[model samples]
Target: MFAIAAPSASAATACAKTTDPATPAAPSPGKPCWVDITPYPFGTDGLPVDTSSLGCPAVNAEKDRGYQSQCYLRVTSMAFRAWNRGLAATTRFQINPSPPPTPFGVWLFNGTRWYPDPTFPGASTCYGDTVVWAGKLDYWLIGGSLTGSGVPTVCRYDGSSFAWQPLEIPAETRVKVLSPEIASVRAGACYAWDDCWFFGPEGVRLHWDGTKLNDDTPDISSPSLRGRFGSAAARVDADGHRIGVAVRWTSHSSQDGVKPEDQVRPDPGESAPAQLLRSDGGAFAPFPFTPPTVPGPDDPWRTNLVAVDLDPSGRGWVAGNTVGAGNLQITGRILPGRQAAPVVPFALSGRAACTPSATAFTYAPTSSGLPDGQSSYIWNSLSVFPDSGDALAGGTERPAVGGTSRNDNGYAEPVLTRVGCAGAVTETRFREPDPTTNDAAVAPANYRGSLDAVAANAANDAWAATSSGSAIGGGIPTGVDQRFYQRPHLYRLTDTAKPAATAGDDVEDRPFEVVADPPIFVEDAPPPEPPPAPDEPPVITTVPTKPKRVKQKPSIYSPKVSKPRRIKGNRYVMVVTFRVRRPVTVGVQALRKNKVVSRSGLKRFKGKRGTLKLEITRKHWPTRVRFYTRSGSTR
Candidate 1:
């Protein structure tokens, strides 16, 4: 219920430590020794800079990167850091998805810095472009996107800088590609095989072996049913060998061919697929699954399996959201194997009972019951701790209060869910410092944000990157006009630390130790000078010239009237934010009190997207102005 205030000096305000009780300070409660790398500095929140992916790959033995732990973060620009160094280096180029068909760029960290792999085209074009180190010292980049010809293309790259090649699969006329995943079969060994799976665009599946990419669409036995559709995959491997994968699928047609309106409506038969399969290099072995029913006509009925991994027992544990209408419910499943039955309530305790709409559901703990009326709980990233076998999930919590669901209010808060190896689910929340107290700023006050990527290190420490809103409009209004005021923040969750406990049956209320990186800095241009007082309208004096009568009735001649010359100040700041292909030169002219004060030299703005403030000032307040880029007039 607390609010944040705008900066007194300028409309541009960033989330930082505040002295106000309403907005607290950060850093003190944050995890100790967590790295705080700066975000991409060239652009505003959205365009050129985007921290799209984060990974804490095991330090390769080949590269003695003196650090004990290393992290790679990719935005449209790429950056990486070795924990021991405590500093990050970034690429000069603002990576953007090249036009359709062209591969996006990919960067690699050799040891201390990051370098773009020339073998790969533009910056990573899609989220699926993931780097995997399997058998030998080599690595692979699996990526997917629609080609210019509209053909869905999925390709891979070798770590030794080999050219990217499309996975060889049976060519179908048209297929939409889902995100791709690569499961490492061996830790340090090279010859062991890794599995790459791609699903979607009508239940089509691409299974890539170490040697070739195969169209494994036939793995679905029920061809008559509507094809499976979903974008998450989890494969469990044992001793450098493949075990199986837990995939979520929705059947187009069940035994009962219900009407389009009737399908997905609150019904017992609405249950969908959450199957486990073991493809032994030939065909897929199937296991039975019962999707939970929906809660209401507008609630979730069908299940979606997105995150999956194996428990110590080698049984399949999967996590996903059940969504429909406007509501969403998190769901998890335990696959006992081909012949054994699936367990309904394997993780998280609440919402165990069945509903007409959603037969199964997982409970998410929140302080305020059910969140804002319009809020939805999203659980996107999940990983298993190698040391304790516990599962960690991260996502965004968008409360319904403050601003409407359609508005920027209800800023998102990052949430981490810990599913103990024994299935005890607990939720922890993190936010930027409020300047008042670090612990007081547990949730963001403005704009929308979410956790996009998450990974767990060998020490059971979890790292996540979240795109959250700037503290622009918690309760305070900066009166600045802009489409978005959001930025990204990185977080580290330490398992060994315990948070000050709170009282509640809801597991989410429990405290947990977490450290947040400094918020990405976004400069706001001061408000534009109030439009120069509009020039006064000319006044017409109707002198006693009523005598001006011409032939017919009277030929009325119009008299030329001139408005007083308007004089205005010269100093003004022209703020502009835009994305570009390459840097362009900009010129500005300032007039003070009806006279030219200064003309700035041509300044170049680097592309893809950047925020620029061209300030022209003299003794008087700036009034009129002219601006130009090489392309021409910058209106």
Candidate 2:
């Protein structure tokens, strides 16, 4: 969108002969015109300069307005350089003559403008920290070591500003030189910043209760048992009480002689099965089920748990990559009760065509418009919507068809996998616009980069951030300059509205249906038409006989229900297991207090047997289930 106008003598000269009614009268020749820039230039200050004509709309003219104007300008390289150079010669515009280098810290958006962490004295020290956890009411806890002293520190944000929270490190951990840097945090619903837990290297655990940090490391039976905690997620109730907490714990050893920075990498032969610690507003303990295995024997370098998240209903999800196999997988389970299901493969689609070779992963369009190769994903973040149990995993994907090379030689596009509450998986890939086009407007798309993080709120509004460059193990295209993609980008997704019914349209809103095979019959002859006419039998030469029919047995049988488990406040989850001789439509409803409060609308099952989970929110727990099949219903 770089359409620069010819340089004019003044603003008045640029707008002198506009025919459009919206155009305002030209301003005085010496006056500066207000300009609103897009694709925000983070390192530069916004200032109007005497330069090229933008042919801006007259609606932006402030003839009668006091200050703010509607003049808009898309930021281009030329315009940015001009604005920066003008800052040095002018005194009226108070802006930095030279912007500082990009800081190694997170960026904050205040709806209108972006502020780097360096702008805040309390937050600047925590720059380059890897762990950031969001809390209620826009509160955030950023964990890192003090800038110079290396003392572990955590800065708390109270919506507007940040203040460092005091810490009380345990003597044993300090003496061991365990580092104890905060690596994960889970904020529970409590007064102010109270009732939150901080986890870090060497199993360091601290609880903040608004006043002080308490060393609250859980005690395991085995003295030598230690692990590096990576991610911690929690679900809270309407009353601000913690319902459950799930943390990712990877096996580690202090005696391994690994440096603090390298502690996350397990020693040779030290990788263990994926472990998850759970808490019920109390001390953390091992979850009952085994989490999906992330590291294989051949590729032990894979992180144990890349990301973990909990839905509002307390269901937990774990996701990570399998480097050896070049696959990304995710698993979910109802917390503290159900068994962790096997890693479910993403139902991938919308893949771009690419050709796989030893040195290159190149897109090769097919005549039929079909993709040419398989795609592989590398997950970076996972988030579950608090209101809906839907989850989204964000990362980059590249073609992985038949290449033997481990290096990412192909162009990678941001990809997202969404898991719905109804147990459906969908994958989406966002490819930047083609840069070969001659249009200048399409040129900016070349700088768009890899998606790194994603988050969704209770409103189901989602936002994702992209880093400016290729991901780890990823590479830039052969002919592109790296500097052009230095700035990161953010994107937001709004939910789509459902289509309304049209007038006079008789659309049937029917649920899933299963039709059983027609029944077989064994016919029986009528007894000689009865004494039909016993009196008239002598006169009747012949009599016709009708047949009786009998119905055959059904193919579906043997249904079982599990005990109802309470999730939170009157909400319970119950599972039903059944076996069918053939595929059928299955539905379930919970009977609570002689009332059917919830139902799992009919769903088609292709397998001969499976389990259906039903959730109900009522005062009384369900005692039994009413299972439905196409053939009939069962208790």
Candidate 3:
């Protein structure tokens, strides 16, 4: 669990004050800033866990415009690594007596502040869960129980509150599977909230249609297929259809060793014949496309599909690593209608130069032992913007040096590849400022980890989640406990390409900090109005005769309510009408014995303010109807 302290208003005011107060400051429009808001000491309770998923709403969308620059990071596990050697007596580990019952945590940012979700419903006590943005103020949580011995729990947020959805898992498979491991969750392309899909290992697929869950598992008769990973873009086509893609493969690891508690990673022995499944608003089926092949020998098991994403135009992007001959990073696009494009090899040129050091390890030539530079560039996560076909691939890049052995040292840095719509690729490698230096422009320190997850909004702004720790083979110094060296980190890349705001610019060169203190721009005051001229006798003119004043009635009128119409089990819809002269918020309440019991929540009505009709849905029938507005009420 993590706790976030709200940034104080005083601190914001102090940062907004200009250093040179005599001169007005010019706005630095489209200036990019990287804010490092990593929680100190890792998890508040125990060791920090890797972020499992990242999601964000389209910042440019009309509905999400108010939630400027937002992203959600979900962490659902604990880190436990066994070091081979003992540490010095001075180094001690903070060990928890037991893991928390509900270890799932969701963190969010709202342009100004980053904080954890206080009202997350974690009744399942499950170790595996994911949160995905459905729509405005709506998100879906899907995963299995903590012990992986029961049916998965599905919860949803309905704008105002959270509730457990009545997801009906298949009765036959529920007992046999024990716990289902959900690998990916996506909001339905056509209906974000009303329709959603959950995918898991072995081709398990479940669909929720706003009411009950339906088993949409595709017919995968092959026993060799062990895992199925898939992703869908949130864009709907002209025909109101959403497209998605999935990869089914067999892992080299034994079934008994594959535990639900373990984080999802590409197994060394994993092999796929490049088989892909496509979803077109229905159950997934085999597609006629061939993924990028490994260059070495013609071995089916040599290539592994690590991540897949579909853009709004139904273009599919796949990222994976090939192990044969020499390790190679591969990425390519699948055009609409199952058309496979040329494989785009990840370019190592034009990347930030890596720092050479004694502790640096060379990129390994094979995946047999530890992952070295050879596999460093393989993307672990992929995110494609729905509005723009632009995509981002998160992985590690060892630009420090190229060698055959782990002893050949070079620092590894987290890398992000931006794949443009026109097939152009740009790479950004992150390096943190040296902590010992007061000047940020000095030599930087190596960021020794991979970006495990990444998300992008429609504005092209992106966020990446990684951890700060010693990389394997980046030899840890004596007396330093490896367990205490790692901490979860988050980085935000603001898109300065959007139109400049009318307000004052962001805090000048605000440096990244451990705390979540967002730059608060100062709003420029309106120019003073000029004084009326007094030199010309005030321009005296005859005034027209005034009409008599007429008193008007109140703008809000009483509501006309209709009887509740039962639609389904315990659900009913009631219609209410309100007459008003101006726009106002309307609310409905269910009452018993003159006491309010249930509320429909206030909904704003702004348009031609006459008679406004509203449909309120409730679970139970009310004895009396109470309709009210901000100004008036009617029972």
Candidate 4:
């Protein structure tokens, strides 16, 4: 295992690149040009930032608007970390749930001082995204908390102090809302949507007033409907109107690896009862989905969406995670009228998947292995920041932005890259020497699936949250062995009046570390219990257990309506690796006007090669399907 060193005065301290990458010109890996994340030695070789008598950091800005600038990061000593077991306790990579929640804040860098955002809401708020309204630049947001755990509140960052201002939605309006993926325009108020989260069987959307943000079911082409949503990305569009979107991954029966904890209600349609819904502003008509483009069978799962900025002019872009099945294709809808989707061409191979919901368990690939020790907890939320465009003649276009790449160390940190400007999703490894990793862990050095949420601000900065530590000593991720501390890591990358740093210089800068409040102790507790085996029947046997066999009849492919299974949105997967010899193939389908519109598909091959394309597939979402050859079924 090679290690990344801190930037030093001695001889440039050079080392080997983690993965092989092409030029940045490539759109999808298939494209001729693509670029990998260039590394620099700015980190402290995993050392804590020296706060000392130096007190808090002073506010700083980049030198010129075009030359190289740096944010050499610094982690606050008060910061907590939860690594190893805490992350894997759940089957998927998500935030670790604490019996008692902790509230904390991290002061961020805006050139100079580390600004602060107070504690995370109640217990349920861990996994989700954040949104910053750049139009209101002096302030930013740190929202996307969970329901019951907390209402989605926006925090204000005024250089020094941080405070929480709740999003105001009219009470009594029962719209189940999740973390909102938002986008702000240099003009108009910001707009956001809840791609996932639901109320009484449906998901909802909201609006953010500078003071308090809340739910505002924007009327759409189709009636605002509901579905299962997961990861989503956003950007401003060509119109300058803040046209953002949220995505939910849902299916008829099976979805993701587990059965839907609950079912979707009020099918998008009613008379005959439509299944999906879309919104325009006044009413939510039936949202007509076209079999939108998706990365192939091997890519990570993501839905395509676009947003437009609004004001004296207009500008913005679209965002979608490109790594599908194996295609790694993401696109942008910058041009108005009829614009084609841009396919990202950088293919990162090692990422593999397909964990099916109970409905499609039989179809998952047989031998695919998961990133070691990784488990996705909750689909925390998505936050879109207001786009602050620079002045230009002949109407300048809105800058496009998207997802963060994981450093080799395994923790999925973020990066500020060009979604359409440069091409392909920017990436690195979740490896050691990461200036990040301020929490404890479940297993030693295992930081993959812990984060439950992700958020982004106008200046191209983003934040991802997860629970890393707990109450006692030697728990999942206790002591100095911390990693994700069940806290939010506020990471920001800005395009200032400074020149961009070379790949070398970029890696050497220090990341500003924000310390947060201690975990909050949750009230109203419930009794803890045991779970069941994945494929086996319950061992419960008593009276009715009197082995009674009825004459079972089988004919037409009558769907086998089995009893529902129990899952805590609580448990985590054990740290384990199941590998596949090759890549698995996947198929895709789109829905619109309450009917299936288009269908496309791609393939993802497997590999350990230093450099490879990692495309997330449609099969990985809602129905996170994973194929297992030995079981002769998917799970």
Candidate 5:
């Protein structure tokens, strides 16, 4: 039977890189992450040096909207040192070096050709923690000087060119939960599900700042106000002592953000929904009137958060993709715990109207002849087998700038024998390589770059980076547009025959293969899903069987308006004339000293066309006529 486990994609990597799932095995000792996955960088200066020896792009792809662009950058270290001499290739346009001199550049790996990331080379990207930034910290660093402040964007990696591309999605766009980072010294973490994060009437733009979240991006309308924001964060600790912090923005906040259950209305037999319940670290009785709003209703702001402590008691932080009952959500560990009972505090919903309508995926790397089982740099979580599958996972240190291949046509797999998670290093891979397709939007090959991703397990390692190469090996979807399709794929480091399991670790030239579960885990009780977005309101296709009100319009002239409208007319009778439409509002005033001379008996009118005969006009005539509307406009 073709078995599909009902587990998070992370949980499926148990037997990753192994042909047989029935038995537990171990992969050969692997090297550091940098050695397993290959990447290249293009700087603002030019091409970088190449030490990986994985030949550079054979040809440079074109630059266009439909086609990819081209550019170059200098190569830096992948846990070691940077190199020189490489190529920039892609179909996105121009592979310009990102401002502030990013060591990591993006590449598109086409089968026979290589395409540099022609678009914004490094200004701003969704790729999270994996990539190295100036701070040496692992959070998703975003500092491309295109502030739109009418001034040149400022950044540290300035090689002259400092232009930021316009934002594709407009502001006021709600960001649900952006799971962008969790950086440590050892393994890194990040993930993006536009389906999960893109949300709300106002799109979100929350980001993490290593320790706390800095959600308050200047509002376009306000510019200085730091509003409620969404982001990701994590802190590292070993044996109880704090090491570092990891934080990220999953997707801003949920599109249809969190709301109190409509105040509950006391549920008749139930206690007052507002009645607070109490606990020590939890809620207090009657849930103090901590009104979600501050000061007043017009306050217009509130902030929500999701954070992590990498050093859990047993279970590590839990992060992954989850869906069921038409509701989808992205969950992250809030409290630091262990692999068994890690904190699963917060979750983002997928019911947003901004669900991912299209998707693109890469090859479903099959372990086949590779090692049986092993944890990867990305999957070294505490879970024995996060996933119930046979596979290994990994990410590359360099940007993907060559051809794509699933087979192992190389030298030695990584050689780091000490297989374990670290304080500074926390390992993690992507949700899935399943192609999420969209035609107009060239299917993105998510080798989201090392900053964004790259993990390696003993059995197999996987990396997602910009590629201009055609997919290799197997598992690509049928009838895909290979001509311009530089696809994404997972690669398992093939294993060498082991001698025995007597060694302390599965690595160190061992005999019996060491098998571990997949890299991800989710709670048994499903997480909460956000409400549907407001954009795509429910569609009512069918016509109503019963008749309904159709059209109605008000007349222009009225009996009272025939003559010059008088302000003070018949006392008890409003002699002014106006027509009545569906339902409208209008304000009339006797202008005096540039102010409306409203009297105690100012009469309120109901229709658009009315004969206003006031009883007390204070012996004055009306000055001006004005129209108002309840529907957000002036008539």
Candidate 6:
């Protein structure tokens, strides 16, 4: 007998390439994600860069109904050093350098191709952290100017060309806005800009009415307002309209010389660092309460709000991290609409814990599970697709498994997480070839890049940008200008062919294929041979019991044998019988010798019966016969 062992498909790696069940699957209802075709450098402009902003079809575009008509467009920011001449090839589009010798440019994608927009006034000086938002009829671009004029610039696209405009603001407000965010609103659009600081009145909000811009700067003089707001999301609510902002307080008021254990407890009456803001008709106010203490034994590590987005239910989601010794520990929560918001932290794995309570954060499981890498991972932006209602979180992560540390001259992976409307979460890490191994066309054990911005269309198509390329082997060889290799990259996550998503531990047996115990074949053990017939004493007729038969002729009539039955290996048993007209002798024997192997006692003419049982070890036949005298002759 032979046996075959068939296990579950998910438990085995059927192909050379398989999803690491250890990592989170890419957003749900889709296959795992792979690195996009675009290439970007690891670091540029002597600072960290990311694809900070994305513009797709606006969520409220359909609300405008008949007045809305637009194509899918995605814009991302990226910067390169002035000395990098091979930068043009780093992006999907051509990087047309400006007269001021601008090294950076904004890349545009129209479904199939990438187009570089280099005429945006200070394109060279702009950091790849460009803020892009799509309106009903135009697309807006806002960022700092390269001229170092301490002024932020805005460029509007009129379908055909871009018109640049410098904002009119007091120099005291700090002409440059480094971390800027834009949200589409009904009146026009609302934006949050800052002077690269958290304290004081360093943050400002700009409300545009399509024709003019108004300033709505909040008060920062109060210690209560000593935080910075970098993330903003606008949604129409019952209270007219609501714009939700993520506030990350930059300072801890007291407990200077406190011990580690004592540091976990906040000073009495101390305000929470993570707060929510509600803005109605340009009047902004706090949400009336603070978040429950996040999981931590140490004071929240260099924690800052980096990403914010509203789910289909209008609940706000925030993602940030507390900086640790060499890495950043990430945590997030969902902000409900009510004033008394309940603390619902994201379920994290390992030593991580939320503050005030040891209750584990609840998180939806992924195919491979959530990323528990050893190093740091930070989210840069988040947005919800209007049509699919899927929430996307974008950021960069240093893979816990491969390569050296960023400080040790290594790489990071760009990560995109998709959360379904039904609360299913899928995480995907982008994989790319190592630019450093171009000569041999090799991939780094851990490829690194930053996705600063992400935008998705109604079709569920998405796009992201890498602000710069790797410091090592990242750019294509350009003999004319070596600096061209340090260019940034833009990529699209369109609906393309991909592998099926693995179900992991969630896999279940189908109804028609339920599991069952294996069958057993008892070949070695055989049925026991029928017990040998008990030995019988010879039969003798008694004179008184049996009347004397006188001159009775003996005649044999019929004979028969039972079919053989196997009781053991190559062993069988059979029975035979014969009839006699008078007291006749009968015998059963193998035909080979014609000798009785077994015999029956005498029988009377009334008929007598006997039994023949034997084991057939080899091929043989048994014949039964009887001899008797009929009349005076024997036949």
Winner by lDDT: 3
For model 6, residues 10-40, the per-residue Cα lDDT tens digits are: 2222211112445333333343233343212
lDDT of 5 by residue, 496-530 (tens): 32211111211111111223335566669766998
- The TM-score values for the models, in the order shown, are 0.48, 0.46, 0.53, 0.35, 0.23, 0.45
TM-score of 2: 0.46
Candidate 6: misplaced stretches above 4 Å?
A: 1-35, 38-104, 117-119, 122-128, 145-162, 171-201, 236-274, 288-302, 311-313, 323-375, 387-389, 403-411, 420-423, 432-446, 467-489, 496-635
244 in model 3: Cα distance from truth in Å? Answer: 2.6
- Clashing pairs for model 3 are 126-146, 354-400, 360-409, 363-373, 364-373
Following a full C-alpha superposition, what root-mean-square deviation does model 5 have from the true structure?
29.0
Worst 10 residues of 3 by lDDT: 80-89
When sorted by TM-score, best at the front, the candidate numbers are 3, 1, 2, 6, 4, 5
For all candidates in order, the CA lDDT equals 0.38, 0.41, 0.43, 0.25, 0.25, 0.38
| lDDT by residue for model 4 (1-635), tens | 21333222112222212122432322231222111112321222212223222432322212111101112221211110100000001111123243222222232232222222324232234322233333212233333343452433333333211233333233423333332322111111223221211211134444443334355443222322434332222233346333232333332112222223332323343322222332222223443333133322321122222121111122222222211111111122111121222211111112121111121000011122122232111112222223332110010011122113222322222222233222223332112223233342222111322223333333333323332211112223323322222211222222221212111111111112223336668899688777865797769866765667896432111112212111123211111123334454432333333333333223243542111112222333222222223323223
Alpha-carbon deviation at 574 in model 4, angstroms: 57
lDDT of 2 by residue, 1-635 (tens): 11222212221222221112443343332331112122322322222221233532322222221111122111110000111011000001111253232232333433233333333343334332333333332233333434455555555543312233434355444444344443333222222334566666556666666556667664433322345665666666556656444444344431222333433333244344324566667666655334343333332333345466665346555554332212222222111211112222211012221111121111222233222364545565677665555666776555443222221233454556666655566555433322333232121221223455666553323455554432221214444332222233344343221111111211212122234456679899777555434343346556777778887555456878776555455556666777877677778877766677777767777777766777766565666678766675655
Is 5 or 6 the stronger prediction by lDDT?
Answer: 6
lDDT of candidate 1 over 373-412, digit per residue (tens)? 5544556556555455566666665554543223323545
The candidate, 2 or 5, that scores higher on TM-score is: 2
How far does residue 306 in candidate 3 sit from its true spot (Å)? 2.7
Q: What's the lDDT for candidate 4? A: 0.25
- Candidate 5 Cα misplacement greater than 4 A, ranges: 1-48, 51-105, 109-115, 119-145, 148-165, 168-196, 199-459, 463-635
Backbone atom clashes (below 3 Å) for every candidate: 42, 2, 5, 231, 175, 36
| lDDT-better candidate, 2 vs 3 | 3
